[model samples]
Target: MSKYLLNKFLFTVDRDPELVERYRAEPRATVEWWESARANRILGCHADESSTWLCFEDAEREALAAHDYPRLFELGAHPFLTLTLFIAMFERDHPPLGFQTEYARRLAHVRLPYPDIAT
Candidate 1:
């Protein structure tokens, strides 16, 4: 719902199908890898024990499990890649109920049918 630059995490996941699959297959390992990369300065993330970073990581996990795309966006997920993130997570076994559940969750926060939509 905001005009923001491409989100590093979602952008990366969007571009790399392999990475998306990896996250689908190994959420814990993927998070662990990110933590290692950030801690070792492999990624641009600062090597600090910042509570914000930890919170984001935890939020990411929760978002994935709950199929709460808006939650990810609130935690700095890319708006453009929001749908893609949902698709990636549920690609293997698409369940109607699961999709509906996620859709309802997102719909609750959606502002009308226009400008409030995430850019």
Candidate 2:
């Protein structure tokens, strides 16, 4: 389920540059954007509110920084989406300090075969 959510986010952002811009400009607006996408059938993901809107929070950064994949994944964060969030953070000139390291840490921990991750 979480994997699918992450895929949806990636897909949405890949196709919608404005959404990425919005994410870069307003990180907190992610939930609103996701809701709009789901409502409009733009996001081809399940419409469950429980584990879908976990992208707007500072703890997300801390979780990644600490390599606490369980906490992040349990909170509905797809590993790839976490990477995408990092990219958006940087691309929008809002790079989180040590975000690259955190991303590398997560990538190193990835043991599954996800298309987004080269590993």
TM-score of each: 0.51, 0.44
**Model 1 regions lying over 4 Å from their true place:** 1-6, 38-68, 95-101, 104-107, 110-119
Clashes within 3 Å, all models in order:
0, 0
Instruction: List, residue by residue over 1-119, the lDDT tens digit for candidate 2.
Output: 23444445545664677766665566546645564455235334455533434342455444433435445554566556656655654644435556666556655654554334221
The alpha-carbon lDDT assigned to residue 114 of candidate 2 equals 38
How many clashes in candidate 1? 0
lDDT of 1 by residue, 29-100 (tens): 775664445323324445563323322345565564454566665655555576666576674465656764
Best candidate (score: lDDT) = 1
Residue 83 Cα positional deviation in candidate 2, in Å, after optimal superposition: 0.9
In model 2, state the lDDT of residue 68.
50
